[model samples]
Target: MKRFQVFAIIILTGAMLLVASCFWPKDNIVVGERIIRFIPKEEILDFKVKDNTQNVDSVIAMLESRAYGINEKAIRRNSILDESVFSESDYFVNPKSDGGGTALDNFFRYLQKSDSSLIRIGHFGDSQIEGDRITSLLRIMFQDKFGGSGVGYVPLDDVTSPVSYTRSSSPNWVRYTVFHNRSAKGLYCPGGTVFRYRFATPESTRDSIGSNGDTIKIKVPACSYSNATVFLKLFRGYSVAKLWYGKATEPAELKVYNSKTNELLAEVVLDSDDPFNVMKLPLKSNPVTLKFVFTGPSPEIYGLSFDPVVGVQFDNYGLRGHSGDGLLTISSDLLKAELIKLNDKLVILQFGGNVTPYVKNEASLNNIKNSYDRLYQHFRKAMPDASVLVIGVNDVARSVGGTYASYPMVSRIRDAQKEVALKNGCAFFDLYQLMGGENSVLAWNKKGWASRDGHYSDKGREIVVNELYLAIMGEYNKFLIHGTTAGK
Candidate 1:
């Protein structure tokens, strides 16, 4: 009898706990650092095909319509060098704004007159391009068609994974940027970040300069190019710099190795008295690792650019958590100096994704719009000759009632971005609409094209980039045919 009574009490306790768990105060509960949410009991397990098929169909039709006038056979014959194959308009420009010409027109002009000078495109984005995924592919596409050699700008300290190049540095190196580190104050260049290497002890007390300084190794993959130019933008307080190339296990000594044959190519000593210096080295072949050993006062290194004399150089200036507002923080003089050095012809701003989640109402939306306006104005004032292109936010979905749906405020944020672009005489690309509006992320997730809530999978990225390429080339082709006679 006593055993039966104890069993009844145990069942009652279990029932009580289950009932309490189901009746929480909020829909989502915070346990530790993670938010635990209750799933709806009647959630749909299977994917429901939303009625947005027309959106994608319309995009395809637009691409097809743009290809109607071109000679398909001739394009096929010389597709490698032909830009017409990619001509399709996926961008919008304001009807009444006088920045003079379209960004695409400016870029086309640069492409035509790139023999004497190098034309550079600065692609600034957030985590969408963290590992050089999108930027590297774009670089290859541009370089292949535009007759350029060498990888473009690489930051002094790589914060994200690199696809084309491998960079490893000593542990003593420190990174400073305009975004994250509040205490770090100074004039940042167009890249918005810089790296510095300092000795633990005073340089005077160091036993040996080579033994105490930091060493950085950059390995380039094998390719047809046999020469590379290292462009360095230096800040104050730099003395002697040594560059060694070739296969060497030791980091203390400088060894000359053949850049082509991977044999010790050459040894060069650099003096850091100027703000900017370009060091050119002849490589025996591609696939070479260059080691830079520096010892002296700490030097603020902007970036190391490897590029040929004349070609399209796409510089990836991606800052992980920036909302495009940080550009205003950089002094205009410093920003213009770097842009002038690069001969920046086009500036692509890929933001809005980082600022989407916090936009709850009209006030928040206005704040973002104002911030973008300031950023656009800053870029315009700094680079009057350069064109600006703003890419809108991608589709981000959150779980609602156990099913993934687009955030309610995404459209508002995108509209705000469009307003800012129009107001600043900039071109706007609707990434959200291009991805397929309204629950498109859910469809992408269903098809395994999205990795998580909103981030694209490899396949998804390829699709989006292909479309973007078509859009850019399409506009460029229109500019070629119309020759600025038509309104933007």
Candidate 2:
């Protein structure tokens, strides 16, 4: 009896182990354990037979049934060229410069000679960059390398997730979706503004230069929404002074005799209730910590440009579920305004993560291309001097044949993006290919880099950052070489 019991126990233990192995949850999937196995799409060959005419129909039907909606033929060949070619004035007009080489490099080359304190970067996308997923990492990296401060153009009030900038309270705000052309006017506390928020209160800060004197010189950034009013307030025993403004406003030139002996304060304000509202503030004061304020009605504001900087940095204008088309239709004027500020600036267009799952046919693929083309056209019109860089869709996962497969539509989108980028004098980055071609998401999941909670895990984001950082760095290096050698 004891020997029989021991045998049964051993068998039971073995069965339990098998069950546990079979029921384990996938690393990055939100599905339950039993449905989380890695069943390759190729292994699920469950097609059927029929008559001759039915046979062709069957094949097409089967392919479509298996998520083969991608128009493999629609993809264009890569045409981006080396930065050296961009130096020729004729090269700029050449139809071919529109594609190929790293898009990031093309944009940077435009800013190499600019006197701005920081180069401005805009990362527009769907849900990926929300809460600073990809944009935050890019900001830290870029700002560290370049010189800038203040989280660039964040919405006045954020409801979807907590922004890294100033926190908000009260639910009485209204929300608007640039994608659907919908506004939460009737709803309670929409929590979003249709326009950029501009502050009116004067902001004070210590002069980077020793403020032993009364006058400080500052420059106003070349920005959109030039129609703005800045209010300078004197504080901390600081007296009021005559204010001057300019694209190159300098605080060092302020005329004050022994004014530095007494404490003085200055308040600057750029007032606007429209989107794309950006203005620069230039002030001169004694070397003390300064306070800067922007006062406004109902919390509508825009971009603030400070003196002593040559370039603008990261501006987080990412909207959830935004298809990049909303701006074209809903806020064309505002977008145009923003583009004006960015004239001769760098525009990084990041998208494709949201459209991958919805693509179903060639028509859909073409439609997406057209949509992007429109978006690109508007951007071009707004910032004719700036360069545009379109990043192909990143690696993402989809369920196929009862298991997740790296959707092939990603490639189709990349191809489409490349074609569009090249056609419009823009640059393209094959983000999907950069992340390891097909099914890289699976590796990310298996390696525990991604979380099973749907969105990318923190680890997964880091991995993405690593790859993107390399790509951007390489592109920047190319710009340096070409700018020094070719004069592009």
Candidate 3:
């Protein structure tokens, strides 16, 4: 009888604790504008739209239908020529087909010439390609096939720590960007970020370097490149600069070092008054470091360009947290002149992921499309000869009803991007579908291919980039076969 009474008391205590826990104050977590609270089921459901589930389902269906043409077999194919399946909407050919040839046809013709001139490909994107993830793989593959030797463009003051190269600058260097809390003066060039070294006046002097000098160092990884070119601009007020390239331990001097050994290679001083200058220097071997010492007035630096004398160069112009519209901040004339100088043949714009989270309705979607269309038109104006390829947003997921599901807005953003690309006569790669369409992030996450927060894992990146490479090569192969005929 006493044991039964004790058991009843224990059960009553447990029930009391459960009731008290329900009444306890809950912590609210804010994500974007939504506040999340661990509350009663009724209260949580009340905060969500009544048709949210149906809307997500409808968007998923649409995405699935659109992705039906993604040839999984072609993506997995080993040989480029054997991969033939591709949707017409997957990549739009310029309808006008300048000079009786498509944009890609022209590129292929250039590739066949085997000339000494470089074929530059400018790849601009948001954080998706930051840190040289996708661009680095593409660069290696292209260089391996086409005979290029160095990693392409490396920004001056990069926020995204690039794995391809090591860059460190003195804290005194000032970084300026074209978009998002923009710089107060000077225009941004094709390479989204620029660096400036300002000298402190007598009253503002803080560092021992004084009012006249600063230094920055760039070190290529152990096996990346043997040569590099530093792109600089001497503004009206700036003066001369010196470049020192060599092994990390070697003294800075103009001398020849063994090509296979890491030693001091060479040094040069630029006293030119030209507004823009390209300083090309050879490195002793792969994994060489270059130091720049500015001894006079401040100079505006664009970035470093690294590539071989021949073959294709892929430049990664990745800006974090950017929508495509930031390109508009740069002057059209400057952008055009830079493109012409770079000999850019192909321009890839990968964006829309950053804008997806804010997409709430049709009007918002249209706004994104309109913004992208304007950007596309600007690129066409800037480089009419270049072929533009727009890569759509990747799959992003959000937690809904205690389960992670694909963000419903991602499909709409993808659709808008496709429309913009087609309307602008540019090719479109549906990266969202290539990532396996709606709710595919879950699978990727489960396979350790993507982070729970939605960014791709290293393995996931390889899988997606490989598929993209196949698609690009497939198009190139098609061009190789028909380009000559079309030109005639």
TM-score-based ranking, best first?
A: 1, 3, 2
What would the TM-score be for candidate 1 when compared with the true structure?
0.73
Model 2, residue 218: distance off in Å is 53
In order, candidate lDDTs are 0.62, 0.49, 0.62
Per-residue C-alpha lDDT of model 2 across residues 347-425, encoded as one tens digit per residue: 6677777787787789999999998888777666666656676767767776555455666677888788778877776
The better-scoring model by TM-score among 1 and 2 is 1
Give TM-scores for every candidate, taking all chains together and pairing residue i with residue i: 0.73, 0.57, 0.70
What lDDT tens digits, residue by residue, belong to model 1 across residues 1-488?
Answer: 34567679999976675566567555577888999765433333335433333345555444334432334354321124355355345454523336555555666777766666678888888878765667777776676656566667677565776665766665556667777763264645575776655444222222222332433343433332112223222211111122211111222222334333445545544444444434454443333355544444344556556675776777788888878787777878767776886689888888877887789888998898889889888887888776788888888876665455677889888888888787787778888887667666766665666743567777677666666665666666555655641435
Model 3: how far residue 266 lies from native, Å = 4.3
Identify the candidate with maximal TM-score. 1
Q: How much lDDT does candidate 3 score?
A: 0.62
